[model samples]
Target: MTAQDHHSTDLQRNLTNRHLQLIAIGGAIGTGLFMGSGKTISLAGPSILIIYMIIGTMVFFLMRALGEMLLSNLNYKSFVDMAYDLLGPGVGFYVGWTYWLGWVFVGMADLTAVVSYLTFWLPAGASFSPIDQALISAGCVIFLLLLNLLTVKLFGEVEFWFAIIKIVAIIALIIAGAYMVATHYTSPGGSVASISNIWSHGGMFPNGVNGFLAGFQIAIFAFIGVELVGTTAAETKDPTKNLPKAVNSIPVRVILFYVLSLVVVMSVTPWTEVKADRSPFVELFLMAGIPTAAVIMNLVVLSSVMSSMNSGIFSTSRMMFGLSRDAQAPKMMSFLTKSGVPANGLLFSCACIMGGSLLQYFVPNTIEAFTLAGTLCTILFISVWIIILLCYIRYRKSRPELHTASSFKMPGGVFMSYVVIIFFVFTIGILSLEDDTRRSLVVSPIWLLVLAIGYFGFYKPRIKNQNTPTKKF
Candidate 1:
């Protein structure tokens, strides 16, 4: 094994094998695969499956790279700690803060989904009233806040079930789709659809390259929490053993959950016929002439939101704890509760949710609200990944021994890391072109600027003597 003394110091490995398993599964499947796959299908046609598979391949390597780094040494508490050790404290500051913001933006978007799902009980246009929306959104936030404030085990347990529901929903959908294919049951609309429907309409990229490219825009976000499995390593009980299981199975699961699921959906219903603005999976049942598809999908999406929010709470708190331990955040955040959970940090994040939920209620439309928030989420997440690549480059140079001895080393060594970084930059450039995402493109750089200011404003001043070893957090 590689020497752990070079990295981890403060992280206590408290997460269990089960927690790691559920967390990784939840990360692979997002709300998008459940709800937004239709849009991907519309843009890319059945070729959306191709887009998902390609994104999965790239994301798998990124997670594998992260696992290798975290497992390189026991001294490494988390990725931010590794960044500090290998790339110096400046990169750590940026990575640590940028990572936290990624979840915040994500959390806000998930919260929006929760409110949207709640509208199922209300009259059609009821959500249009700001006062009504505010009260209900606040109530939803409070429900999640309570869930988060409980024991981490409880949170993990809930996520386990949430993930199970999502998994089951997909399995049922796939099974139903398979039966229809085998029996050659025609759609109620009197259309005889078959697996050939995937190709016959547009021959995969029927909508053209623009559709395929647009599919990437959505596919990338589906892969957002790909690295989150690493955060739980410190909390994860028996991480060395369990982490491998979760991390290694990622490729197979992504292919099954995304590629296979979409193939089935498109086969059951033509990609061209799937709803573009709403969920495709549910639409398949709806189009199959099932009356209860909307209700069933409502439950599925609700689980997706809860899972995302629950994860958001867990990950953001860990980031805060890491930052405070390293003096990037207030010290109180570093302290843990009796259950070994960072109680205060969790509450602070929940508080941020309340603040944002209030803003979302006042926003014009839920889609408008989510688009704005999702854009910022994408920016912060993109920045966080970029910093990871940057840190890995320095990691290879500064700690050659770890690089050489590492288990599950990132493929492509330092070169591919740079390549991924360039891809991320290009994504930013594309975001700059779209009216919806352009504003977030403008705002995201300010976070980097603020971190630069904070480093100079706070942490850098404390590192007065280069020769004197600083506190290794």
Candidate 2:
């Protein structure tokens, strides 16, 4: 066999179509959807549904472009691989590190959220100190780290069940909401829970153009993990077939999990009635007279947060592995266990999460820390998406033969690339309008500056040395 053929066996293709399907579903339905939907509904009223659909549409095209490029060269593992080849090493290094940090922070945020959720069951008074929560969060991370270090299939199995919980919860919520609306059940507040609640509260765009724009801030975060499916390219059993099927189902998942769920929520409880500080899912169950609403929603959300952390770990480990192969990170990170898991990278990522957990423990304001980390994550994710689009554009031009020969060509091709890029720009501009979100806009430039310094100061010199031949040799 050829040397390349032998090396291909290093990453075992153990992820079946089933794993890909649910990972896609779980990735699309994030903690943001559960935690932030209440605020989004209050912000945009019924127009939030439109906002979700718009973002979902743009992301669909973006995934297709990524999938097409991935399929074009089976050697490519993730978007970073595409950037390294189509763009330059500088683009690759920047995008890779940014994406890694994005997940690192995501893992951090979810780790904190998990601790907060766990504290609900803690006995009040002295037993519920921040130390206890930190320990609990650390334990949970350790459990996930151990499970992930087992095998790729194990990670897939865990995600599959986590996704099943989320799906069933959403489906059950929709059914219950539909039943309440059909019977014209009135909430405890005496407002008739009807489909009209969507528009009855000061019409569809209740807050006008500005309120509608406000929805984008939270709604965009809801879709943060949607591109996670793209990260599974290397482990997938059949990328050409399974990848396309997973990509095609994104819109369906978004509609069902996001749009439909929100519609049912607002219909059962008016948008204005939904509390910004609480989950709408819990609110709906409580309004329907379920005494265990908080407990039930807590369990579901805990699972959702765990799932997000799981995905973050998986993506970050894989990213570090790719970076090591490119000589952009410590070579030890590229080593794999007998089961094809990146053990060193996994441990390194878990260590970072542990540090963030300590930060969450010391910080008196958990919300502020969450906001800062989440905004940083969103900005970095957006940057990576823009890079993917740019790489796709470059792929089309530099390899017209491959573009034309490929079966899964992006529908609008390069034109759609520009369209999505512009949409991202519009979203960034919208961030500037909000006082709370504007900090993300201001801080984003500093992040770019750090990345520039890292790439030039560290990666550039080593890359030049590695590429150059020694005269003595």
lDDT of each: 0.74, 0.84
Score every model by TM-score. 0.91, 0.93
lDDT string, candidate 2, 317-435, tens digits: 98888888778899878888878888888999888877666866785354455556666688889889999999999999999999989999998999999999999988888888777
Clashes per model (N, Cα, C within 3 A): 15, 0
Candidate 1 lDDT, tens digit per residue, 330-406?
87787676566676788787777666667676784665566677778777777777767777787788779978887
Number of the top lDDT candidate: 2
Give me the candidate number with maximum TM-score.
Answer: 2
lDDT of 1: 0.74
Q: What value does the lDDT take at residue 334 in candidate 2?
A: 83
Q: How many pairs in model 2 have backbone atoms within 3 A of each other, for residues 3 or more apart or on separate chains, i.e. clashes?
A: 0
